[model samples]
Target: MKEKYPNLHRMALDYLSVPATSTAVERVFSQGRQLLHFTRNRLSGNSVRAFLCLGSWMRHDVVSPEDLIAIIRQKRKRPSE
Candidate 1:
């Protein structure tokens, strides 16, 4: 098979030897699905791209849900007299 498909064999060998798994790819795709669930039938190309970028960053720990929720709560709170 390698002799018949040299490029594919090389690609397979390279992938097998890489340190990174398909986990990141799966995670990003999962996030994209989640983002699309609520926005299905209404998302533009740019909107989808933005969501994917944001989702990828979130997966990479650039943002925390707790902090986001706290900020939202603070903004929604009325000022004390």
Candidate 2:
């Protein structure tokens, strides 16, 4: 198979090196789907990645929920002007 499909093998090696299709990946995808509603469909890839990473961190207790609350409050404290 390798000899007959050398190019396909290389392509698979290159593109199939991503993370496993685990439950965690499915959970993130589910959350991202919810975020892609008409209002938020414009979210950039980076924003979606950040949102997912943050949620993952909180879910795993890498960052405390209270810290997220404080961060949100800090963001809200900024003056629009």
> Which of the numbered candidates is closest to the native, going by highest lDDT?
2
Off by over 4 Å in 2: 1-18, 21-24
Q: What is the TM-score of each candidate against the true structure?
A: 0.40, 0.58
Displacement of residue 72 (Cα, Å) in model 1 is 14
Give a tens-digit lDDT track for model 1, residues 7-62: 55655553455447799668767877887887495899898876675454455555
| Model 1 TM-score, all chains together | 0.40
Locate the minimum summed-lDDT window of 10 residues in model 1: 10-19
lDDT (C-alpha, whole model) for all candidates = 0.67, 0.72
Residue 49 deviation, candidate 1, in Å?
Answer: 1.5
